[model samples]
Target: MSQSPGILMMVIAFVLALGPLVFLHELGHYLAGRWFGVKAEVFSVGFGREIGGFTDKRGTRWKFGMLPLGGYVRFAGDMNPGSQPDPNWLALPAAERARTFQAKPLWQRAIIVAAGPIANFLVAIVILGAFAAAYGTITIPPVAGPIKAGTPAATAGLREGDRILSIGGREFDNFNDMAAFTSMRAGMRVEIDYVRDGQQARTETVIGQDVSKDRFGNEVRRGVLGIAAPAEIVRSTVPVWQAPIVGVERTFSLVGMMVDGLGQLIAGRVPVSELGGPMRIAKMSGESLSLGFESFVVFVALISINLGFINLLPVPMLDGGHLLFYAIEGVRRRPVEPQVMEWAFRGGLVAILALMVLVTFNDLGAFGVWRNLAGLIG
Candidate 1:
């Protein structure tokens, strides 16, 4: 079966956006494996049945697959495609066993596994840094603008021209910093330090929650302080030398946001409905592409950071799971038993599959698939 033009375009765009990131992530594992004297048997750009491939002189088979979702690298002595250690790795010829991933030193194996996530972060930093250097950034002072009547800002005595100095001990030079901080603390009371007419003062206010919808009609709830930015705006051209620094700062800031959101979710403060999956990501990818190259690049950079951070999670069947095993080995002075590793990976696979189902259901709802179906049936 063939897809319609619109569907095809979405598929292509999704691949273009994700393919490079996946390739780089897998390449990190391959290159690190080679560096540490482990032999890579296969390098794939997707999963399932192979579409096309060629063997290199070093005997690595590089191939593409039908599924465009993600890719993986298979090292020698991998028990299965998922890279579990083979029980027979010890029985192989000494020369061949020496080249197997399981035979490598603990540090080498850990590096090989960690290299994937590290590459993702590096790619995001480079893309964001390049854009920052080329296009610069916009800035507005943290001075208070007109407070919305009957809102939290007005209730807390925030007045026009009051310059925001800090929130929760974090100082800011731009309104964005304060806004970012405030928006994340919905329903939480915090001390806001500011200067009104050159007199230092502090006000405690609980951030108000407002529910709004995006262009796609997805509901979003955010903390609204009922404060607006000053009328004046500033645009500054960042030097190439400083762009990377700015990129690093921006990357860390985004990571912090993710951490905060995860913490909120775990604490039962945030609803699970806000979580999105592949369909939501595809819809977002198309929307971002329509917004132009800069917006799309920024979106990609953000996703890349997320990819890096998520892979570092200590879940089985992920890079972080492998690292966890290595950590245990380091502490216990021996490798985790192959049977235990197998069961862990199996459990991880089940957990991952369940998560996928949940997120996909959420995506369908977010995309209004059920609503549209109901409308048609009605």
Candidate 2:
């Protein structure tokens, strides 16, 4: 695994992470619509050419599409792909109109629209917490666990149970501190300090630069000891039991950060080009796969939360956008004029498409294609 090619890793991670999350997201909307007595016509994991499909007892054609990027759920009267409604269908008998999305109670409509992203967040929280509870966290205290026999650390006479006092002569306490130092000084020479057999010892070695791509498909250089994670997993009866709570807290913390970052991007303090689209996300999924299944699962959950949060934003053309219209209708006790709604929807549609383009450009930059293109042009 240490010698695995970086490119191959990026490819696998992208699919594993995004594919399931998307399907689950669509499922949320599908289930909610059903709950509200709105039947689904089609449930697809992607758009366009059909890879595979089946008609369920309910007559819903469930299938996987060719693109494998984005997905959608088509409701019974969703003549429009967006599932808002068709006015011509609404012009039919009152009973027919009742089945339409717009005709449903405002609360039900809101739930159906909000369901997609909500599922994403729930999946993330459960997956992360369950994983932590299942696999007791590893406490990589400064103590030596196992050093690869042929690695530099092993050759330097380091032994099991030796407590690492410092690396690169800088005092370090836990794995986090060591990681911080190693990252800042990857591929550089350093001296390791450890207490072995109750005696302090120092060994000189150079940290290896791991030329790897992160889950996001961005090239990252990190310090490596050419060692594998140890088998000494700590089972914290008390701490492990609280994994769910901690996991939710952690997820919320991340959400807060993303919200802050998006706020900055909107404020123009952060570059819109820094926003990543699906391309970058898939690439990242591939990279995360290389780290290990645990790490990959954690990332998958995070992406789910991100999907949930992103969809909740009150922007048109999105699930949240429909909810916005519903809110406006509720406030005024009537639907906004069709012409006015169309204009606003179009404006929002343009904004979303523009943002998509910007993010795709960022994804290209993240994958280093932008740099390659720049070099070629020059």
**Most lDDT-accurate candidate:** 1
Q: Which digits, one per residue and each the tens of the lDDT, describe model 2 over residues 216-311? A: 444565566644444454546426669878678657866876775576456654445657898777666665676678878888988998888888
Model 1 Cα displacement at 321 (Å)? 1.4
Candidate 2 overall lDDT versus native: 0.75
Best by TM-score: 1
What global local distance difference test value does model 1 have?
Answer: 0.85
Give the deviation of candidate 2 from the true structure as CA RMSD: 9.2
Quantify all predictions' global Cα lDDT against the true fold.
0.85, 0.75
Each model's backbone clash number: 0, 9
Error in Å for residue 346 of model 1: 2.7
